[model samples]
Structures are given as structure tokens and as C-alpha cells.
Target: MEIHGPGGISGPDRPELKPTEAQRPDKAASTDKVADEVNISEQAQLLEKLSQVPAVRMEKVEEIKRLIEAGEYETSERIEGAARKLLEEL
Candidate 1:
């Protein structure tokens, strides 16, 4: 019917609660004042730029799909051109 614990609600035996150095408001405020920084790699920056770029032409994509379906997308001339371009890049 009565509550009794280590400190007995309020007495000298009751352990005082205080914030640690890390938990103190002043210490926490100083840590919050530090400026956060972020570094983006060149590749990531390029990717972000690419994301903002307009999407590929749907008409051109549809045309290529139609040609592929008709078995006419990979002709000899196109193959030769692709080979030439690959060699040029290399």
C-alpha cells in the first residue's frame, strides 16, 4: 500500500541525475555549430548532370524498335559504321 525504493522519493540517498559531457547543452551546441560538408566525385557529378538532360527521343526509339522487329536494324553498312566508330574511339 506504500511505495519505497532506493532514494525513498527524495532524500540524501537518492542518486542525482546529471548530463554527461557529450549530453550537456553547451557541448552539444558546439558540435552542432561545426559545418557539415559533402564531396561529390567527378563521375557522380557527371551522373547528376546526365540526370538533368532531356530523355532520348521516343520517335527515334520507336523507329529503331520497328527496324529491329523487321530484322533490318543491323545492316552491313551500319555494322561497318559501328566498327569504324569503335576503332576510331580506340
Candidate 2:
């Protein structure tokens, strides 16, 4: 029993088969790498902006501190007010 492939691709004459590295990457590995980069850049930019706006978080901090100092902090009231205002603005 002898085998002969067309165009001279006979037994032992063909090159050894090799898997290519350019094939589709491992989906989970690629997604994790991209997600890591995105998280790093997002946190970096957020910190930079927060640093530049010295008064941004300060205003919020002052409001909270004042409430805490005066014992006027009401969680439900603030939440409701903020939710209502947000809805109105939207």
C-alpha cells in the first residue's frame, strides 16, 4: 500500500506542520490585559483632575464637615434632596 499526494506532496517530502502564533489570542487573557490598562489610566486621570481642582472636593468636604460638627447630618434628607435635585436637573 503506497500513498502519493498530488503535486508531489508525498509522504515524508512535505515540511513538518507547525502551529502559527498569529492565531486568535486567548480571549480571557487579552480581555484581562486590556481591562488592567483601562483601570490604570482611568484612576490616574481621576487623581490628576482631583488634584487640579483644589476647591472641587473641598466644597463637598466642607459641607460634610459642617454638618458633622453641628450634628446636622441627616442621611435620608440629604439623599432625598440630592435625588430630587438630580431628577429635576435631568
Candidate 3:
């Protein structure tokens, strides 16, 4: 079957039958390929480093626990200061 285009220009009279590589212009390689490259941003590296740190400091936790056991952990001023700081963070 003949395929018609603009201005009545006809396509190939017959489809290719075992056309060689050089005879087939449409078969030419048109795209270029390169090796994939990946880059890590500075922020990502910093986040990764931060993730490696422990969420809670065991030494500080133990010290606070000891103070509570000694009946020295509940000063009103200290509690007010902590509450203020927490509100400020929010």
C-alpha cells in the first residue's frame, strides 16, 4: 500500500525487503548514550552525618535520673525556665 503525504508526495512504492544497513537511511543510529553519574549535595551529606548521632544522650539522661532520686530535681524556677524554653521552640 502507498502512503500519501502533503502535496500528494507518495511514500516508498514498496516496503523494504531485506534492505542493507547502508540502503536503510531510517535505520541510522541517532541517539548518544553516556555512563550515569550521581552527585550527593552538601545538605544531604550533613543530614546523613546527623542521622548517625544518637537521639538521646545517655550520660545526660543518667545524671538527670540521679538528681531526681536525690530529691533535687524539682525547683520551680528550673521548671518555669524549661517550660519557657519549650514554648519558645514552638
The prediction achieving the highest TM-score against the true structure is 3
Which lDDT values do the candidates have, in the order given? 0.84, 0.76, 0.85
Model 1 TM-score (2 dp) = 0.42
Worst 10 residues of 2 by lDDT: 30-39
Off by over 4 Å in 2: 1-52, 75-77, 86-90
- For every model in order, what is the number of clashing pairs? 0, 0, 0
Predictions: Cα RMSD each: 7.7, 15.3, 12.4
Pairs clashing within candidate 2 = none
Residue-level lDDT of model 1, residues 1-90, one tens digit each, is 344776356656557889887776673344445678999999999999999987898889999999999999999999999999999999
Give one digit per residue, the lDDT tens place, for model 3 in 30-77.
Answer: 677577999999999999999999999999999999999999999998
Model 3: worst 10 consecutive residues (lDDT sum): 7-16
- Choose 1 or 2, whichever is better by lDDT: 1
Task: Extract clashing residue pairs from model 1.
Answer: none
Q: Model 3: clashing residue pairs?
A: none
For model 1 the local lDDT of residue 50 reads: 94
